[model samples]
Target: MRLLVVEDDRTLAGLLHKALTQEHHVVDVAHDGREGRELARSGVHDAVILDVMLPSMDGVEIAHQLRAEGIVTPILMLTARDGLPDRLRGFDAGVDDYLSKPFAFEELLARLRAITRRGAPVEDECLVVGNLVLDRRAHEVTRAGRPIDLSLKEYALLEYLMRNPGQALSRTLILERVWEYSFDSFANVVDATIRRLRKAVDEGYEQPLIQTVRGVGYKIKAQ
Candidate 1:
């Protein structure tokens, strides 16, 4: 998965980038709030790891701006202050998860997984679509107890579909929610991703859960 790391602290930012990259994720680093906001608004990232203290603008303000513009990318806020009021402020500014400094990298990873998993339906640390199961914590997917490997984008697309269940999601809605500001991109990446997701999730299933709505979009339902 691609992730944006917004931090003013060079040392911490470097460490985070290295750690996240080691996990096979693409890490984009920004040293200040303005650059972070610009990259985040580009809508190319799966998630954002943001620091509360930044130059030009703070993380809270950046998050508020993103939310105001209808950007729903899951934000994980990093703060040195562990006060209740500070955490409350971060939540109010639209942070999905919070981690204080001097934290374990394992804890950070756990929180990231938890928040991203919660963003979709199918809880219990895994996503369930009929007999298919996706273990978010383990990053594993199985159908009829058989393991299936998927790319990060495919996993994200499938999770979104499963979370919404029977809701008919428009292409525009999917692009906005999953791809950030996808209007400028000329490629039909969303369609391609959906096709790949369907191949993995429904190729051998008795009844396909994903349904196309002609010219509209797609929906996932049991029946």
Candidate 2:
């Protein structure tokens, strides 16, 4: 899914980008509140991750403007201020959820998934490729009724491949999406994770769903 993240702090914004991208979600970030508002108004995003106390236009106003314009994109606000009135203001402005600063990424991810689910009532929570299944809501993976164990990074990489099946995903693209390091330095990370994925998903199976495109990267295709 594509997402919009509006944050002023460069450091925090970088962290958010790394985290969200690692989960295979394409993220667009705006450091200025006004710029962020413009991006939010584009309507290309599945959801918005907003930070309050922004320069030029605050988060509440951005939310208010988007809502006033009848843009119903789900927004999850992040703020250091956790006062009732602030929360009330945000809610009044059509914010879907709020998370205080210093919060856990797990909680943020949960809120994001929940709000996106609520925003799009018909969206599928589970992803399927052949008999291999990934239940995003439950954070579980199984192949042909057999449970598959994977680390978080492994799960994320597999999900990405499953999301874009049969495509020749390049090493640079996978590196950008799966890990938080530079492609030149972390090129081996993708290879390592792909090996881990094959061990977990193809070790006991007759069909190998994960395939390599020569001179490119990898893909997940059913037999």
Candidate 3:
């Protein structure tokens, strides 16, 4: 998954980026709340790990702004403030989850997975299109109950496609949602990633779930 980690603490931010990258997640780091808010508002990240005490805007305000703009990307607020009032404020600001400082890395991972899982209404914790199942929480994909491993970019692309199952998603839409402002129409990164995603998601399946709509774009649906 693509994640945004917002922390003013340089060491901790670096640590998180390294750890999450090692876990096969594409992580972008922001050292202050203002920059974090900008990135978050772009609506690219699958999830956000935000620290409350930040330079400039602060995490609570960032959350509030995101919600005000109608952005529903899941945010997990990290804070040293374990006080009930502080936690409550974070929630009121539209944080989906909260984790106090000095927390275990495993716990953070689990919470992130939990937040992303609850974003979808499907009860299985796995998105299904035909016989294919995408376990967002587990970061695993299965076809006919057989496991398929995907790269971080491939996983992000597939998850986006699955979330909007059957909708014709243009390449421009996919680029804006998945890669943020990093690439434009000239970038073939989207095509390459989609090719890889298609291979992993449809290679062995009897019917391909991803379909091209001539000049329009792509859509995922059971054939």
Clashing pairs in 3: none
Give me the runs in candidate 1 sitting further than 4 Å from their true place: 1-48, 54-57, 60-122, 184-187
lDDT of 2: 0.85
Query: How accurate locally is residue 145 in candidate 2, as Cα lDDT from 0 to 100?
Result: 85
lDDT of 3 at 23: 89
Model 1 lDDT per residue over 1-223, tens place: 5679999999999999899867866567889899899889976566899999999999999999999999888899999999999999889989998998989999988887777666554444566878878675566779889888888667767766776778888888777656544573623787888888889878977798789988778888753
Model 1 RMSD, rounded to 1 decimal = 6.2
In candidate 2 the C-alpha lDDT for residue 142 amounts to: 96
Error of 1 at 170 (Å): 1.9
lDDT at position 10, candidate 3: 95
The candidate that achieves the highest TM-score relative to the unseen native structure: 3
- lDDT by residue for model 3 over 1-223, one digit each (tens)? 6789999999999999899988887787889889899889877577999999999989999999999999988999999999999999999999999998899999999999899877455664567888888876567888888888887767878888888888998888787666654455534787788788888878866788888877767889844
Question: Highest lDDT, which number?
Answer: 2
- TM-score for each predicted model, relative to the true structure: 0.60, 0.65, 0.72
Full-model lDDT, candidate 3? 0.84
lDDT of candidate 1? 0.81
Query: Over all chains combined, what TM-score does candidate 1 have?
Result: 0.60
